[model samples]
Target: MSTSLQVGKILNNNNRITSGEIMGSSREGGGRGAEEDEFLLQIPEASAKVPKDAFHLAYIFYFTLGAGFLLPWNAFITAVDYFTYLYPEVSVDRVFAVTYMLVCLLFLLFIIGWAHKSSAYLRINIGLALFVLSLLIVPLTDLLYVKGTRGLYSGYYITVAAVALSGVADALVQGGVIGSAGELPKRYMQATVAGTAASGVLVSVMRIITKAIYPQTANGLRSSANLYFSVSIVVMVICLVCYNMADRLPVIQYYRDLKMQAMNEESKEKGPLSGSAWRSTLWDIVGRVKWFGFGIFLIYVVTLSIFPGYITEDVQSLLLKDWYPILLIAGYNVFDLVGKSLTAIYLVDNANVAVAACIARLLFYPLFLGCLHGPTFFRTEIPVTVLTCLLGLTNGYLTSVLMILAPKVVPLQCAETAGIVIVLFLILGLAVGSVVAWFWVI
Candidate 1:
C-alpha cells in the first residue's frame, strides 16, 4: 500500500501496528497532506497572531484616515455655489484646477524626494493640522471682513490663499496615508480607497443637508458653508487621533514589525539602496508594468473629465434646479463607494481584462457628450443620472483594482514605490483631465 493508505490502515487497526510503524508511515505520507504536509506544518509557525479587535480597529482607522485626507478637497469641490458667491468675477473652476494641480505636484515631488523618509504618522499629523488651519482661514476671514471693519475685496484674496493652502495639505496627507497603507495588507488598501469614496459621499450629504437647512440667500449660504467646514475640521481631528491609535493595534504592529524585519534583511543583502539603485529599482517596476500605469492614467483622465467639472457644473435639470447637481454628485459618490467596496467580493485578476476595461472608459467621453447635446430625451434627468452613476462606478472599481494590483506585481522592496508611482500617474491623469474639461466649452 502507498504511505498515506498504510497510515490510514494503521490508524484504523490501532492494536495491529506499533506506534513506531505509525510514525514511519506518517512521515512517509507527509507530502500527501494527510495532516502531515510541509505546508500545513509551516502555517502555524509562520502566521502572525493578531487580536480580533485590533484587526477590526485597524480597518476603521485606515478607512477613516483615507476619507479624512480627501474630505477637505471634497468640501472645496462640492461647495461650488459658495465659492462662486465669493468670486463671481473669476472662473473658479479653471482657477481651482490649475492651482490644485500645481500645488499637488510640487508637494508630491517633495515627498517622493525627501519627505518619504519621515514617519507617515508625523506627516499625517502635520497635514491634518494644516487642513484645519486652511479650513479655518476662509470662514474666519469672511467673519472678520463682514462683521468687523476690514476691506470688502480682501475676502477674495483670502479665499484664494485658503484654497491653495488646502491643496498643499492634500498632497501631504494623501502621499503619507497611501504610502503607509501600501506597506500593509491589500485589504487595508481597499479600505483606504473605500474611505475616499465615502468622503465624497459624506461631503455630498453635508452639502445637501446644509443647503436644505439654510436659505438660498448670501448670508444663509455663508452660514451653510461655515457649518460644512466646521464639521469637516472635526472629522479631520478624529482621523488624526484614530490613526495614532491604530498604530498601537496588535494587527498593525505585526505588519509593521514584519515590514521592518524584511527591510533590514534586504539592506543587509543589498547594502542599502543608493540613489542610482533606487532609480534602477523604480525603472524596473516601470518597465514591467507600464501598461498598468497607462490604465491607471486613463482611468483618472476619464473620471476627472466628468466628475466635479461636468457633473457639478455642466449638467442641469429644470425641475430639480440647483438640487440637480447636488443630487447627481451624491449619486456618483454613492455608486463609487459601492464599486470600491465590491472589490472585497471579487476583483478582476487578469491584467489584460482590467486594462481593456480602463480603455473602454474612453466611451464615457462620447456618452457624456451625448447627454450634453443629444436628443432632448438623452439630456433628461434619468439618462444623465444613469450615466453619472456608471461613470462613478467604473472609476471607483478600476482605480481600486489597478492600485491594488500594481504593488503586488512588483518585488517586495519595490512595492512602496510602485504604489507611489501609480498615484503619480493618477495625479497626472487628473491634471490632464482637468485641462481637457476646459474644452467642453468649445
Candidate 2:
C-alpha cells in the first residue's frame, strides 16, 4: 500500500518505471544490479546529513510548530459550550467560525499575493505572539471588564475580537509553516500534519480532564475555561521558542541554503517578477497541479462539511448523552492523528490514485445524510461514531499525502508558490464546506 513497498514490486518487474535510468550500471548494463541501484534511489533520503546532529530536533520542531498553530483554534472550538453559556443569546459557535474563516482567508490572500517573498520566520513569530495575545484577551477581559460591566455584550464582543485575532494569527503561522515545510522533504510535511492532528488530541484530552475534575456547576465551567486557556497560552509560548530555535538548527539552515540557491538561480533566469508575473506564477502552479489542487479542495470540502459544528450539534446519542459528541470528536482526532502519522511509514505516491481517492470522499455526504434521515439503525450512535472515525482518518491521511507530494511535482523555485496555492485551495474548500454545512439546519 505504501510507496516504499511498491518500490520493491516495481524492482521485481525489471525497473520498468524509470526505464532503468535511475540505475548507474549493471553486468548486462540493465539487469538486476542496475535494478537494485534504482531501488536504492527510491528510498527516501534521510535528514541525517544535517550538520551537528540537529536535524531530528529541527524536524520535530516543525511538527510542534504545526501543532502549535492550530492549538488555540482547537481550544476555542472545544470550549464551545463555555462560549454558549457566556452568551446565551448569540450563536457564538457559528459567529466564531464565520469571523475566523473570513479573517484567515483575507490575510492568506494578502500574504500569498503580495507578501509571498517576505521572511517566514518574522511573520510566524509575530503570528505566534498574536496568538498568545488572543488567548489572553478572553480571560483578561472577563477578569477586568466583564465583572465590572456585568453586561453580556462586552464579553461577547471581546470574545469575537479574540476570535478574529486568532484568525489573523492562523493565517500567518499556517502560511509560513506550510510554505516552509513544502520546500523541504516530504517527511516534514507529514510531521506538520501529524502535529495538527495532535493538537486536536491534546485539546480533547484537556477538555476531558477539566470536565472530570471540575464540578458541573457554572463556577466549575468558568474555572475549567480559565485553566484551559491558561495552558494554551503556555503552549503557545513554547511553540514560539521552538520555532525560533528550529530556525537556527543546522538542518533547517541547510534547507534555507537550498531555497536561497534556488531563488538566486531563478532571479538570474528571469528579472524580478512584475505584477503580471505574479499572476502568471499562480496560473502556472494551477496548470501544473490542477488535479492535485482539486483533490485538496475536495478533501477539505468534505471534511469541513461534517466536522466540529455538524458533529457537535446534529448528532445525538440517547445513551451517552452529553459525552456522545465529546467522545466522537475525540475519536476523530485520535484516528486523524494516526492516519497522518502513518504516512511517514508508507506514503501513497501515485498522484492519480491519490486524487481519485480524494474525489471518492464525496460519498461521505450521502452517507452522513443517510445517517440523519435514513433507516433507524443508521441513526444509532455506534454507526455514527464509526463513520466519524473513518471520516477523520481519510481526511487526515489524504490531506497530508496530497500536500506532501504536490509541491514536489513542480520545480524547486515554484515549490513554495505551489505550497501557497495548495493552502489557497484548502481554504477555498473550507469556505465552501462551511457554506454547505448550513444545509444541515435546513
Candidate 3:
C-alpha cells in the first residue's frame, strides 16, 4: 500500500484504540487470542499528517521565544548570589527555594484541575497573566525600594510567578489550547523535540547576554539583576501580545474544529477510557518506564553539581578582571542550540527516539564529569570552554529527547499530567544534587 494509505490505516487503528474496544481476545481462549494479539501488533497503515509550516512556527515560538525566557532564568537563579550587587545582602538561595516551592504547588494545583476536567484554557490564561504581572512588578519594586530590602521578596515572587507561567504554558500547549494552530499539523513527538531545542538556544543566548552586560561593583561580582528584570519584563509583554495575537488568529478556530473532530471520531469509535482505568494505566506505564525517569534524574543531578561550580566561578572571574564573557556565553549557546536542533530534526525525520536519547546521555555523562573534575579542567581556560560547549550540546539533546518521549510513553489523555510528574522529579533531583554539592564542596 501507498504511504498515505498506511497512514490512514494507522489513524483508524488509533481511533479504535482510543475507544474502549479491545482488539484481541482474552488469554482464557488461548489459540485465537494469541493470533489476534499478533495481528494487532502489526504496524497500521494510517499515520498522522503533520504540517511542515505549522511545525516550524511552533518550533520557533518554543525555542526562540519560550526557551529564550526559560533558560536565562535557570542560569540566573544558579548565579544569583554572584549578582547580588543589584540587590544587596539578600539570600538568593532562599528566594529561589521559596519561588520553586510556590511553582511546584501551582503545578500541583493545575494537575488537580486537569484531573477534574476543568477548563484548561482558563487555567492557562490566568497562570500566564499572573506570571507577566509578576515580571512587571519586579522592576517596579526596584524603583520603589531605595533600601533594596524589598527587592529580594519581589524577585522571589516574580520568579515563582514565572515558573508557574511556564508550567501553565506547557500544559496549555500540550493540551491543545494555546498553541493548537501551530501544533495541529505537526506530529506531537516532533513538536516536543523542537520545543526542547528552542529552550536550549534560549538559555545559551541569555547567559551570553548576562555575561556581556554584567555591571561590576566593588563587592564581588557583576550584577545583572536589573538587566534580567528589565529584559524579562519586555519578553513577558511581548509574549502577552503574541498570545493575544494567537487568540485572534482565524486559524486557531480551524485548528480547534479539527481537534474536536478528531476527538469526536475517537469517542465514537471507542468509548472514552474510564477515569479509574486511565489512572491505572498511567501508573502502570510509569512503573514500566521508571528507568527512563531515573536516568533523567541522574543527568539533572550531574548538571546541578557541576554547572554551578564551573560556570558561575568562570563568569565572576571574567567580570572581575574586566574581560567580556559574552563571546564564551555565545559560543556555549551556539553549540547547545546546534545539538538540540539536530537532535530534534533527527527525531522528527528519522524516528529513532531511543537512539537519539542514548547518544545524548552518552555524550553528557563523560563530558560534564570531565569538565568539572578533569586534570586540565580550569588550566588556561581551554578545558572550561570545551566543557561549557559540551555541556550545552549534551543538555540540549537530553532535554529535547526527554520532552519529546515523555508524552509518548503514556496515553494521550494523560500527557499533561505526565509532563508535570516529570517536572517534579527533575526539580527534586536538582535539589538533592545542589545539597550534595554544597556539603561535599565539589
Candidate 4:
C-alpha cells in the first residue's frame, strides 16, 4: 500500500481508540499502543530539513488577524446595533439563549456529521471569509433590502454568522493548520496578540470616524458595522493576496520537500496502527493532556458567557455614556493583548504545560469573582474600571494558554479531532454558563 494510505490507516485507528476512551470504554491500553505505532509511522526514515513555509506564516497572520477582528467585536457589534434600535426590552437571558441555541446546533452538526473533520481547513477559511463578507454585506442589505427593518431575524442572522465564524476559527487553530501540536512557535502567538491589539485600535479609530462622518445618527452601531465590514474586507483581501504570493517563495519549496519526506516514511508502515490508526490512537493522545482540556473548559465557562454581558451591563448602567463603553472595550482588548503575549512567550520559553495551564486557570477565578461582584463592591469609576481591565488581562492570558495547550493534549495526527473535542466543551460550557447567568439575572 502507499505510504499515505498506511499513515492514514494508523491515524484512523488512533482516532477510534481515543473516541473509545472518551466514551469511558476500557480499550485505552490498545489505544496507547496504536498511538505509538502511528507516531513511529510518521517519523521520516532519513533526516530532512524542516520546511520553513512562507505561506504557513502568511496563513498564520491571516487567521490570527481574522481571530482578533472576529472575536472581540462580532457580538459587540450585534448587541450595539440591536440594543440601539429595537428590543430594549430584550433581557440578557434572551441574548444568552439565542447564542447558546445556535452554538448547540452547530456542535450537534459537527458531531453527527463529522463536519469539522471532513472539511476542517475548508470549513475554517470559508467561515472566516464568509464572516468578513457578511459584515460587509449585512449593512448593505440593511440599507438596501431591509430598509430600516431591524428585528430579531436580522440580529439572529448576524449573530449566527459571527458565532459560526468563531467556531470555525477555533477549529482551525485547534487542527494545527495554523500552529501544530507540541511546542508552538513564539511568532504565532505574537501574531495573535498583535492582531488583537490592532483590532482594538481599529475599533477605537472606527468609532471616532463613524461619529465624525455620521453625527446625525443617535447611535453609532450602523456606522461602526460599516467600518468593521470595510476594514475586514481590506484585511482579508490583503491576506488572500499574500497567501497566493507566498506560494512562490522559497520557503514553500522547503515545506513541500519536508511534506514529501514525511509521506514517504508513512508509505512503508503496515500494522493495526498504520494507515487508519486515527480512531484507535486518539484516547492515548488525549490521556496525556486531559487535565488541560478540563481546565480550559472551566475557564471558558467562567469567562466568555458570564463575564462579557456582566461587564457590559454593569458599566453601561453606571457610566451611561457611549464613549466610556467604547474606551472600556478598547482598554480590555489592549490588556488582553499584553496578557496573551506575555503568557505565550513565557510558557513557550520556560513553564511546563500543566503548570502554565494551572496558573492560567487559577487567574480566571479572581476575574470571575470580580465580574460577579466588582460593581457592588466598587461604586467609583476608577476602581471599577481597574477591575474590569484586570479581568481583561486575565482573559487574554488564559486565552493564549488554552490555545497553546490544546494541541498538546493529543498527537499530531489527530490534532484536528482534539481541537474539535475541546471546542465542543468550550461551546457546551459557554452555553451552560450563559444560561446560568441569565437565570441569575432573573
Using TM-score, give the best candidate's number. 2
lDDT of 1 by residue, 131-162 (tens): 99998887787677753222355676777778
Candidate 4 overall lDDT versus native = 0.49
Candidate 2 Cα lDDT to native: 0.77
**Model 2 poorest ten-residue lDDT run:** 20-29
Pairs in steric clash, model 1: none
Listing every candidate in turn, what is its Cα RMSD in Å to the true structure after a full C-alpha superposition?
9.7, 7.3, 8.5, 8.4
Cα displacement (angstroms), candidate 3, residue 440, comes to: 4.9
Which residue runs of candidate 1 sit more than 4 Å off their true CA positions?
Answer: 1-44, 48-55, 146-153
* Tens-digit lDDT string for candidate 4 (353-388): 544554455555555455446665554556556765
Which pairs of residues have clashing backbones in candidate 2?
A: none
**Local distance difference test, per candidate?**
0.72, 0.77, 0.47, 0.49
What TM-score fits each model?
Answer: 0.86, 0.87, 0.67, 0.68
Worst 10 residues of 3 by lDDT: 19-28
Which candidate has the highest lDDT of all? Answer: 2
